[model samples]
Target: MADLVAELAAAARNHTALARRVLSDLEAGCRSAPECELRDLIATSRTVPPARWNQLLPGARGIYPDACWPEARLVVEVDSRAFHGFGDAPERTERRRARYASMGWTVLPVALRRIRTEPEQVLAEIEAAYRAVLSRRD
Candidate 1:
């Protein structure tokens, strides 16, 4: 038991170190993305694995959104069908959307296929959603 506890503690420390490195890299990369209206409008930010949402929220269905812009009240989720599979995907997504709605969050699910095939359309949708969220805030 003591050995297992020590191993778990070591793993946790390693994970934290890795997370810091990844976050630093992400911040550096973000500096290169084009500066735009959306970038200026962000309020709060967080990055966590989707499963962590359960810990973030107690009773209600907690969903770990891929990316969230809290100031814009937007939650962006990237869905890679290849990895996530396609069985009843839309239905499950809709349910998750409803859950977010119930929590007063605007959820946007960006499919990997669309991102690869029609990036412009995805950008347009994202911009439109941002605008809509902004409008609601006002």
Candidate 2:
């Protein structure tokens, strides 16, 4: 059983790496018009996960976000339908979002379909969320 579990873990890790690579490739090819404010930010950013927030909230499990744009006061979560709403994922996501909100961070949940079908729109929403955070900060 232990060996089986280990193998499953390895497979999960491999799959995650592949997904990240695909996202990176897609992001790299993203083009923005001159009027878009988030082009630079989105283009330069790599995937930002929750481990980056460990200093802010220690000893938190399953609390990692897809991306954490600290300067922008944003926490981006990529919600794939299969992984979401299964078991306790919904509750877990809510708990994490609340925790981040308590720390004055704006949470942005982006669906996988949106990432694939309307990346530009997703980027726009992220920019708007960041802008809202800035406005609140001021």
Candidate 3:
């Protein structure tokens, strides 16, 4: 899908600015709107470390996090109530987080509402988590 966009952008004669931006975001592994927003925030922030979107972490037991700084062993998951509020989804999320924790992965969960309303705070938390994890390594 991203390849198609890149090709289209390359072939276009004019007005490819938005397509280029979308292609860049897609290349950065952003699969959702929230992930793209986070990617933009991280990209623009000097304090926050860059993270790969929708990547599989090492020792994650097949779980692909929404965003991750693999070097710092930190993961950010955007949890939306629409997805996790039903049945045992919340429990499953908790269990998955526990698994990550047990494997030494720092899972930082951000609510979808918070992502929309408190982006700065979310970036702050991500910076804090990255610092905390790196500090522990040192």
Candidate 4:
């Protein structure tokens, strides 16, 4: 951890005041950075992995998400049927979905094919999901 801090400090000092800004962001408990570069193609506020990342799944400690809007408790997890293999027991999937809902999340699962071929549609749907949750305050 010390080594990581020293390296980050050096890298930040070398760049535009981003070091201090990054440090501040970290100190503010913003760890577990985004997992997907798809963030670059979308417009949103700090779409990073959740702060309470591990809690994303009970009895699981490293449930790092792909993209999440912490304020809205919305997460967009990318799935690829070709790569991940259609391999989850129906009961397991049901339990996981129930846990996510209990955790106050509006989880959005997006297929890799849709993201690669129809990015605009995916973005729109993501934006809509975020907005829907944001409006739940009333």
lDDT of each: 0.54, 0.57, 0.81, 0.58
Error at 82, model 1, angstroms: 3.9
lDDT, ranked from best to worst: 3, 4, 2, 1
Which candidate wins on lDDT? 3
RMSD of 2: 10.4
TM-score comparison, 2 vs 3, better candidate: 3
User: Which candidate leads in TM-score?
Assistant: 3
> In lDDT terms, how accurate is model 4?
0.58
- Model 4 alpha-carbon drift over 4 Å, by segment: 1-37, 43-62, 82-84, 89-94
- For model 2, the local distance difference test gives 0.57
**Per-prediction TM-score, please?**
0.51, 0.56, 0.86, 0.56
TM-score of 3: 0.86
Candidate 4: tens digits of C-alpha lDDT, residues 1-138: 567577776674555466555554455444433323245346343333333322344333445455566788776766555423456644554565566677787788777777778877887887778778888955
After best superposition, candidate 4 residue 22: deviation in angstroms? 18
Tell me how many clashing residue pairs each candidate has: 0, 1, 0, 0
CA lDDT for candidate 1: 0.54
Q: Which 10-residue span in candidate 1 carries the lowest summed lDDT?
A: 45-54
Model 2, total clashes: 1
